[model samples]
Target: MSRFYEIDPTPENYWRAIILFGRNTASYKFALAKALLELHGNGKSQVKLEELAVPYAKHLAQHIKQQPKQITSKRSSFLEQITAYNQGQLDHDGLIQQTTRLGFNNVIDAFHKVHGNDVGSRFFIDQRRSHGGIELTDNLNHLLEQLSAEDLAGEVEARWRLVEEAWANNLSRQLMLVEYEEHDQQLIGIHSQRRISLTSARPALNGYQKGRCFYCYREISILYGSDTPADVDHFFPHKLKRCDDGKPIDGVANLVLACTDCNRGAQGKFDQIPALPLLERLHTRNEYLISSHHPLRETLIAQTGASREKRQDYLQDAYNCATVFTGSWQKWQPRAEGVAVF
Candidate 1:
């Protein structure tokens, strides 16, 4: 059975749910929650809804402006809408319309409202209330305390990066701008004036993985430019399992740097549990990420749960879930034989 099965609806679990399942514009809600948790600190501080809006809007604007242009359609995204609202391009009613269109009203309802009763009842007080503010739940505040301020900030930034990458990749696929060719498993994408490129995390990941493809263990070039020839692969194929909330497992823990051949070779191999050897490599890679002070460590712990035993259990559960779709584990052998072992 999946570890996620029979999970209790505790505050920590609720926070994890948001991390695992929230996607696209809904990701801003999680960012808002984290910011609120940080700002409120230890006590039960009731913060005004308007007070939360400033930081949330700022985050949304920064993310929107920084995203790759190709991934962004001509039509403005919710992030752009939020940015516009913050920049005074939109009136209060215009902001409301954009937020509603982006489905943020549902996100707010989900966070503030209790499990049952009116879904949108009140997780936090609405603007209609005399106080018109949100009170941080004790459980949430406690959860936030598990990480230091630096760690919390790093975690939030990492999550934002993953969300941005995931959206861009998905948009490229949806628009039929990205295609996978069978020959050499090559990926072809419509190149715009500016191509989507990896950030500093690429070098960090390359160093951590010893400048080798995570799947094939072949040495990959470490060129640091837009035309650099390495592929950032989703270790767990995004197409395998559809998330009800539209979020895929695009967290750093689920990403690996690969060569063009390995990435293309594994195309559409969704819901297939990699060989035990690959899984072992992945665990080691995660350990390297944790020890190297990467923000991904926090995300890995959050998804798999803390403690080594829990992490192993979570991975086993993930493999089990994959088997349901794939019928059996799929082992990928390195195409290039006699590659230097790390």
Candidate 2:
């Protein structure tokens, strides 16, 4: 069973699992995703590959112009043609022809696979055999109704940017160190003293949290201008920054998304150490983040410890020190009916 679907079983969460956990050897998946979102339900159940080529090629072309290395490979005939099109060697018509022929070769097959296993829901069915194109599934339609296409598109964009930036900089494994800047609440990538400001910590994290508040497990929106925006909360209060002995208290490992009610409401966890159970939950959440791809995985591993046992000790020690400084800690009691989404 797909763990992501087990979390919420909603079409939106399934789509997010594809975006957050699917492998990215190239940016083709993302480009194809943007194309699908652009063309999904505009009065058509299916789109011919040639028709799909237009937006597919356009998105890839735009990204090629912005960032050159769209694929991990040094050479891809598909990308080469796109580059030629960008350089004026290939005209728009010729570009579309090449995209029709070369694109959709792998992405269509791999889009629904997360970590090599099929997701529980099908967003689109491959119909190239019978229809010479792809057919939009009811799952896609349902997801569109649940969340605006614009919001989903933004998520694809955010995930794409993070992947491409990390690839462009060759930041893999421990080479990349990410730090949290509390002032702007954005993650910063540090390597060789050069700091690269990455995406907002909210969207980068909300998917992993499955769009629910960490404390209450209530559904939360990562959207910036939404009526009730989720807060990028520090699990161990920010003031306890001094207790970690030099480890960054603002690191990604300690950050969790909290709904406004659980964050600043009358029962908010303002400056108090979370109850013991919440600490264990934080450990589980951090491990989940570590299992994910580069930058975040590396960042958390760096901030916490290299091994699981060490990580457990690190959090426990930090929690212990936090309890001491606070003098007396209150156990945060979440509402009785709150669900544990993670």
Give me the runs in candidate 2 sitting further than 4 Å from their true place: 6-10, 87-91, 336-338
Which candidate number would show the highest TM-score if scored against the true structure? 2
RMSD of 1: 14.4
Taking the tens digit of each residue's C-alpha lDDT, what string does model 2 give over 101-198?
A: 99889999999888888888888899999999999888888888766676677677767777887788887633767777878878777877888786
Candidate 1, 261: how far from true, in Å? 34
Model 1 per-residue lDDT tens digits across residues 76-168: 476667667657798766654555456344456555423232321123544424665556555555655542343334344544554455456
Candidate 2 C-alpha error for residue 328, in Å: 4.0
TM-score of each candidate structure, all chains considered together: 0.43, 0.89
State how far residue 160 of model 2 sits from its true place (Å).
1.8
Q: Roughly what TM-score does model 2 have, to 2 decimal places?
A: 0.89
Clashing pairs in 1: 112-122, 112-123, 113-123
Prediction 1 global C-alpha lDDT? 0.50
Single out the weakest 10-residue window by summed lDDT for candidate 1: 113-122
Most lDDT-accurate candidate: 2
lDDT of 1 at 78: 66
